[model samples]
Target: MRKLGVKAAAAAVILASPAAAEMEYSFYIGSQSAPHSVLSGTIDGTAGTAIDSTVAWEGRSTAPPPYYGMRGVYWRESGWGYGLEFTHAKAYASDADRASLGFDSLEFTDGHNIITANIHRRWKNQWWNGRLTPFVTAGVGVAMPHVDIQHGGGAHTFGYQLTGPAARLGAGVSMAITDRMSAFTEYQFTYSDNKIDLDSGGTLETSLITNALNFGISYSF
Candidate 1:
């Protein structure tokens, strides 16, 4: 009798557990605003002397452009979800401006590929009627940025492949279209700081802030 009671309690526990989890994949295309950084510091001059210079850098902010990104997520019935995401963009300048002495026509170009691990908190039920839900998302990730700096009438240039930490915060409203598909639009803000190592010696630090408005579709499988 005790064995039979234990079996019955086990069955009850299994039935009372949460429902099966779901997985979603999303694709989005949108515009990412420009990012800017300032460069300043002292470098090695002749015979171990340090020369200090002030430099101002303008990245994508010089001219705004469009960017695209995607995500794959897994959700449970408990109103929490986790995912992975990727984003790519470029920052360039057509004309170079120099702020530091002894440098002329300084140009900067950069490309970034970012990957992040994201977490989302969502409402357990549709708040406004049916089919409309709200969620907030945040993530921390790493970015691989390709950097190129040119100066001295294109005679001197430094290029480096760099890696840095990045983070973002976003909120959106999702609407159901069908049983397995949904759509959403979100606004996100991201920040990052990276250091570029010059082959000639020393390092350059860059800081960036970007804003994005993205619209996307998600499919559940």
Candidate 2:
């Protein structure tokens, strides 16, 4: 009976102790930018029978909005962690650029869905009574770019979906709200090597670089 009592008391003490490691889930919304403009093919012939070839275009072509994503992380008391994430964004062609492409309104949309595995290191210094933590992260992953091209008046449409490898570097700060929750903001730069083939006898090679800013809340358990 004494041994049983001692075991029960030891179990109670262990259960009351704090955990040395934790897992977190986070969701965030932010802006993504592809700041380079795309060019169209060159034009041949003259007058009404002129043919247009690829031309070097300029300016940003995507709509202004924030992209959202989610992440799952496993962190230890020793300041090292690893995570998995998924994110998405969209891009479109400008109307004037479409007219320059020899169509009434030739427009294209780019939809990207990416999955990544990341490793991070956190700094343990506290600015506001252990509420703040700073981190740096880097990772390599894969992306699927889904492209849709179409005419303005429902004349024709084409889809070119391709998958490729990608890499990213990022930094962020997290502020604690409670024992199990926190808020964070991060900035990341991503580069991808992607290529697409048009149905009309041409190919587009995209070695793209983009920047992103994100803010969100995280829950730890």
Candidate 3:
């Protein structure tokens, strides 16, 4: 009964938050970018794999989704923000090419993601755009990255609890379609570290960089 009480209290806090500057249901779709760093481990600077597409679920500084996992929003500086995301991708390598030399002689694929609890502040228009303003944010959170590899009858998966340091330089625009609702789109760049085992049994540490150019629709209450 105590566990249920704790859950109820948390839910009450979320329902009590006022609209405007609160996190609504926000969804995103994009691709995993090259690995970058304040540290190192990126191949050829900040470009690694091709494109591992993904879909993410994000909520603002409100109650988190219970059915999805432990993901929600919080405060950082003076504003509110959250980056609750998860994704998967797949690829195929030729088994007939001369480049197959000593490889598994089959397809190679991987899937990875991170649920970063970043903080953000939304601003009204500054110049003359009327509904657009350049907003900036910076925060840190947990980065749990995972990868899976398959060959013949064997499959390998690597994952861990890592660190996430991120920054957002983007602009947003919104207009009221009704009295209590608005919609917007934002473009951002996100960065994180990668704990990679490019090949089996050979562990390599590096930072994986991701550029998030996003389009989103939200309904505020």
Candidate 4:
């Protein structure tokens, strides 16, 4: 009788294992907005004085280089999950800043890219016949922004740079569309600390906080 009970328990474990874990892949696109931050740096090498100015950022979401993101997650039945996410977010210094600060070109429109490893917690709700799930996520990673700055009659500093550290927090809800598909909308807040090196000389330092609203679809397997 003891041997039979042990065998039955083993069979139950095997049967439940497949349903206990799953993998999900998602793609999303959205718009972003950033508040004004101070941008400070030195130009023309060590011969120049420090430049400090308040910069207003513009998010050209509808134009070229739109905002987008992708992620892959692995979920356990316990409502906990882990994933990697990549976001292509942009920022352009406003015209007022350019005219006032006398910058010929200043932007990270090509990429204010962020890559992070995220942890998520989700809850299953009875809304819409148990199809709605609400989740929150937090992550930390690095910022790789394309530094585009030309000022003080110096050479153009245009290239990708591993500027500094980045972190994000987000919350959203997902609706099940099919057995293996779901749709979601989320809001994310990201902070990046940038210490970018300039081509003609010293480094530019700034902290950017961005807010994004995103919608997308996911597939689970």
Using TM-score as the measure, the top candidate is 4
TM-score of each prediction? 0.73, 0.71, 0.50, 0.95
Query: If both were scored by lDDT, which would come out higher, candidate 2 or candidate 4?
Result: 4
Clashing pairs in 4: none
| Candidate 4 minimal-lDDT segment of 10 residues | 42-51
lDDT of 1 at 112: 58
The residue ranges of model 1 lying beyond 4 angstroms of the native Cα positions read: 1-19, 41-66, 93-110, 124-128, 153-160
Q: What is the lDDT of residue 141 in candidate 2?
A: 93
Q: Residue 128's C-alpha lDDT in candidate 4?
A: 83
Clashing pairs in 3: 23-60, 35-208, 35-209, 36-209
Off by over 4 Å in 4: none
Question: Which candidate leads in lDDT?
Answer: 4
Error of 3 at 98 (Å): 13
**Local distance difference test, each candidate:** 0.65, 0.65, 0.39, 0.89
Q: Report the lDDT tens digits of candidate 4 across residue range 103-198.
A: 788888778899899999999664788999999999999999888888856789999999999999999999999989999999999999999788
Assess candidate 2 and give its TM-score to the true structure. Answer: 0.71
Clashes by residue pair, model 1: none
Weakest lDDT window of 10 consecutive positions for candidate 3: 59-68
Models, CA RMSD each: 4.5, 6.1, 12.4, 1.4
